[model samples]
Target: MNFAAAVSVALNALRVNALRSFLAMLGVIIGVGSVIVMISISQGAKAAVDAQISALGANSLQLRPGSSFRGGVRGGSGSATPLSDEDVEALRETVPYVIAAAGIIQQRGLTAVVDGVNWSTEVAGTHPDYFIVRDWDIVEGRAFTVPELDGAARVAVIGRTVANELFPAGGAIGASLRISGVPLEVAGILAERGQSSWGQDQDDVIFVPATTMRNRLGGLSTAGVRNPVQSIWLGIDRARNMEAATEEITDLMRVRRNIRIGGTDDFAVVNFAEFLRARNETESQLGLLLAATAVISLVVGGIGIMNIMLVSVTERTREIGLRLAIGAKQADIRNQFLIEAVVLCVAGGLVGMACGAIGALVVESMGQFPVSIEPMIAFVAIGAAAGVGILFGFYPAHRASRLNPIDALRYE
Candidate 1:
């Protein structure tokens, strides 16, 4: 028989025993469905991590004071050797790879009141370069100009959360808001910045000029310093320059702080590029684990298919004998059985994909986890299903073709 005729006969045979055919496909259905759901969730998690890495800015470094030691007792990180504006100026002048540096000081649990509405949030004080170093964009109005920072102007920039709370009617810019009973004009509004990897709300704070915050609002500062700052954010010119820039920064800080050679660093420098690399490695490991599980599932499903095909050959022994007696080629008989197995798996795969898509949506809606279904994922699942059918169906098809025709016909 021709290939098309063989497929037609195979399909008709499966239709006659529809219940048995469906049972034979059950394993593949479950296996493919599980694989699809797992891949979607894994992809979504990796994507989220990647986005956070991007949000951290290119070649960025966070600088904070190291621990304090008093009476042989050590304090927490960033509790000693307070960073100051002078350090920021020194880095800008001395470090060749440094593109931007911004000193920041923060105050927490401050209530901001506009009209009768009140919202409690943190306030950050920094230079105009703060926006540049952090890669944060101002959606409306402008950042702290040089004059504004130098003069300690009473102007502010609000985040998305702060904007919504203080100005629900949508006119936040150029509005007057009071923090700690000090009235300030809203100069700008920041773009939405969702949440941090550590679960902090990025869009729930307010920003003001460092001088204004320090002089007017009593922001955190180093005692006895002319221009004190809590921490510094440095943006490097390029990613490849991170290591060299870090070494330069350390040397400069040590010299400025009067620390001897081999002494512990008084200030900590955190390289966000290295942190991003570590996160990428973690994502790769997770992908491999998920792939291994998918392979095991496909194998188990293939074994089930092989077992069913063997039973099918045994049940149709008389039919096979009659076909051989009628002068059918051995290849023709093998092709028919092989086609039947493939058809079963492919059909099961389509149903499995539908179930997997629905399952992904349900998971996302329940807020348990995020899911992403790409075209490549579905293509791979379907291709694997077809492959399973071919690999497992071959042995049974060969056995059916090799049956003894005359002896079988007489026995029947």
Candidate 2:
């Protein structure tokens, strides 16, 4: 038969059993929908994380204390040895690639009260450079000035969440809020950052000058000496030089701290790029696992196609015998059955693709998750569905081809 005739015959066969055709297509629909939905969600999460990381500012390096490693495993050493004011100054003077750096000291369990309304939140002490490094903006008022930091001014910048909680009527700027019982004038109100996927409110914290936090809060003291810093955040001039800058800073810090070659460096320098890469790898693996699970449904659907094809071969024995007796070649008989199988799978795949697209859109609209459906993924899915049809339909098509004309003619 010609290609057109073969396709026409396949269409007629499917039309004769509309319910069976739909049942066969259901598996592909489920498989494609599941895979697409999982991928869309994963992509959304990755995008959210990327946005948060980028909001931390480009080429930002965080310096904290590294845990003491013992026996090839991480062992918790108490809180990281505090970075000092001297260390911060040394980095500024020595590191040419460092554009800006700010020392941070954080204190939780602090209550801020304004207008008789109190809210418990984190209070972080940082320099004016902190706003620059974090890409933070003062929506209503100015950031702390250099003079404020030097004089250890009791000025505070409240996050959006803190502002709303403490001053529900929205006029928090220029007000005074006592943090940990220390009166601090509200210097500014930060813009809203929204909640993280981990359910943490990114805008619930407060910012203060590092010096004021160290002196007034009194949380930095340890073992008879006041450890004045919790971390130093650095923003690099060039993103491409982050790795080289990180290594140079680490060496500079070690030499300044007087740690010998054999002695472990007491501090940790973190590269945000490394963290982003690790997170992407984990998400990629999860996507693979979910896609595999979804593909199993396609396989199950393929099996259903095979079963139905077998029944079709048996029921059409008389038709096959009549065609063979009239001048049909073995190749013609095989091609007919193969076309029917392919038609079933391809139809099912087309339906599945539409359903998957709709499913992704619905999920995105309903859950507020970003949905990205790459064209290549759709192509791959269609190809996969066609492959399943051929692989599973092979045996039944061959059996139909091998039926003896005389035996098939007498069967009915």
Candidate 3:
């Protein structure tokens, strides 16, 4: 038979046992569907992490106090070597790559009351530059004036979460809210920023000048350092490498904070770029593991296809003998069965793609998980299914082609 005739016969044969063909295709369907869904979700997670990192700033570094060891037990960041206000000023002055910097003093457990509504929230104090460094914008009212920041003025900028809870009404500008028994006027309202990568709500806090936090809200940690801070944030020049910027900052901090060359540095210098790279690497490894599992499913499905093809060969032995008794060649029988298996798997793959797409959408809608499907991945999955058919269909086709004409024709 010609190639076209072989294909026609193969398709007809599959149609003859439609239910069995579908059962044989089930493995490929599941394999392809699962892989696509897993990959889409993985890509979506990576994209979210990248966005959160970018939202931090284009050229930003976060410096927190490093570990403090008390009798071999280590205290984590901000436990020792608190970031003094002078250290924050030194980075801006000493590092040319540093464009803007600010120290943050954050205090929790502050109850904000306005218009008979009370909400527990975080209160942070930072310089005017904190907003600039973070690229934060005020949607209502105005930012703190230089005088307001310096004076530790009783003025506040609130986040969207705080706004909705406290005011409830549309007008929050110029409204007065009291925090910790101290009254402050609403100077500005921050635009809605979404959650962090760590899943913390970004718009659930309030902002005041750095001086105000130290003096009025959260008390000073030490009497010696009048305006100590929890951490220092800086926006470095994007053109400069993060490592170089870190080094410069470190050298300056070592001298200012009085650290010897051999001793460990008392601070933590973190670049978002480094954190992002590590996170991507970790996620990629996880993706690879998932891919491996999906591949195993495909392998299992291929085995199923092979088993069904073997049974098909046995049931068609007499038919093969009859064809051989006629003008059919060995290659013709092999080609017919091979094409049948491939067509079965390819159809299964197509259906799997549709099912997988639906599954991903359902998951996204119901679970709020991110899923981003790429066109190329779908094509790849379909192609993989076809390949599985060819690989597993070979031996069965070979066995059918080798059947003895005399024996097969005499057998039931």
- Quick one: best TM-score, which candidate? 1
lDDT: which candidate is best? Answer: 1
In candidate 2, stretches whose alpha carbon ends up further than 4 angstroms from where it belongs are: 1-8, 41-45, 48-52, 66-81, 137-142, 180-185, 194-199, 214-219, 222-227, 238-240, 320-339, 350-380, 390-411
lDDT of each: 0.86, 0.81, 0.85
Query: Candidate 2: how large is its RMSD?
Result: 4.7
Task: Please identify model 3 stretches exceeding 4 Å from their true place.
Answer: 1-8, 67-81, 135-148, 151-154, 180-187, 197-199, 215-221, 272-280, 321-334, 358-376, 398-412
TM-score of 2: 0.78
Per-residue lDDT, model 1, residue 254, is: 90
> What are the per-residue Cα lDDT tens digits for candidate 3 across 383-412?
999999999999999888898999988878
Cα error, candidate 2, residue 352 (Å): 4.3
TM-score of model 3 relative to the true fold? 0.83
What lDDT score is found at residue 51 in candidate 2? 78
Instruction: Choose 1 or 2, whichever is better by lDDT.
Output: 1
Clashing pairs in 1: none
